[model samples]
Target: MKPVRRRIRRHFGLTAKQVAVRSKRPWYFQWGITVLYVVFGYGIAYWQFAGAEDVHQKLRQTALENQTLHTKIIQVERQLQIEQAAQTNLAQQLNKVQDENMHIKQDLVFYKNITNAKRLAK
Candidate 1:
């Protein structure tokens, strides 16, 4: 029984309770390290926010450029529509002139035939 108890105690690490000892450091040194960590963290946060502001500014500039391009596209489409309409009107006018020229040629040919017949009969 005694051997069994000794083995259990050794295996379980319950032979004795050990206390840990630590050397105390000065409070000022701890406070100084804490302040330095806080200042460093704050500086990093400020830098990140400054970079974000630049990114936001660039995003706004790009948006403005996109809007300008969209406006120009609309203007160009309107001009194209106007030019197409003018071309259609010009084509219609040319067709009308061709038809008028064909009729005038037919009349001239008829007049020439009549004059030639009269001369041959005389």
Candidate 2:
């Protein structure tokens, strides 16, 4: 068979030595493009991190507000319970006073009836 290296060189019109030579311009240009891409990626990541931190702080403040509101509700309910108990006690005392007033009226009527009967007999 014909030599393989000679066959490949003839087909592409390039000697092996020419294919191995590297140019400086394209190599440096590729490195500059890569650096720009890295800087852009880092800037985007930093902005996203800042936004996340702001959201986290707002959530923390909202949670604290929720806890404060819950405590206020509990305290108000306790005060309402105390007021209701005082109202119940006042109602019971008013009923007892009315019962005592009814008994005093009955005793006055019985004493008047007995004194009238003794005067009629005389």
Candidate 3:
């Protein structure tokens, strides 16, 4: 039986030929695997970061929209209160006018009675 000697380049560590001889994978394939893993890691990070930014932007926009809607509601409420106050003032004025008309009618009736009595005396 012959004793097999370890090759001198094998002592320096694995050469491309040695790795191919042992694992049957080409050097380019190994580099491609490394690049693929790097690209996949970067892709995951990019999507996660981008999604977080999108959510944050939506939240900001929603807050602004909510503020705008709330201001509009406050404005509408104030307008309704002002309109209600005006209606109340107008109703009070109408009651005052009706009372004044009643007084005038009573005075006219009293004058008619006085004239009828004077004509009878004549």
- The model with the greatest TM-score is 1
**Clash number by candidate, in order:** 0, 0, 0
Clashing pairs in 2: none
In order, what lDDT does every prediction score?
0.95, 0.89, 0.89
* Model 1 misplaced regions, further than 4 Å: 1-47
Order of candidate numbers by TM-score, starting with the best? 1, 3, 2
Give me candidate 1's TM-score against the actual structure: 0.60
Candidate 3, residues 1-122: lDDT per residue as tens digits?
A: 12233455555536625434465889999999999999999999999998998999999999999999999999999999999999999999999999999999999999999999899999
CA shift of 33, model 3, Å = 13
Q: Please say which candidate is ahead in lDDT: 1 or 2.
A: 1
Give the TM-scores of the predictions, in the order they appear: 0.60, 0.50, 0.55
Task: Kindly indicate the candidate among 1 and 3 with the higher lDDT.
Answer: 1
Preferred candidate (TM-score higher): 1 or 2: 1
The residue-by-residue lDDT of candidate 1 on 2-102, one tens digit each, is 99988877766667557679988899999999999999999999999989989999999999999999999999999999999999999999999999999
| lDDT of candidate model 1 versus the reference | 0.95
10 residues in a row with least lDDT, candidate 1? 10-19
RMSD (Cα, Å) for all candidates, in order, is 6.2, 10.7, 14.3
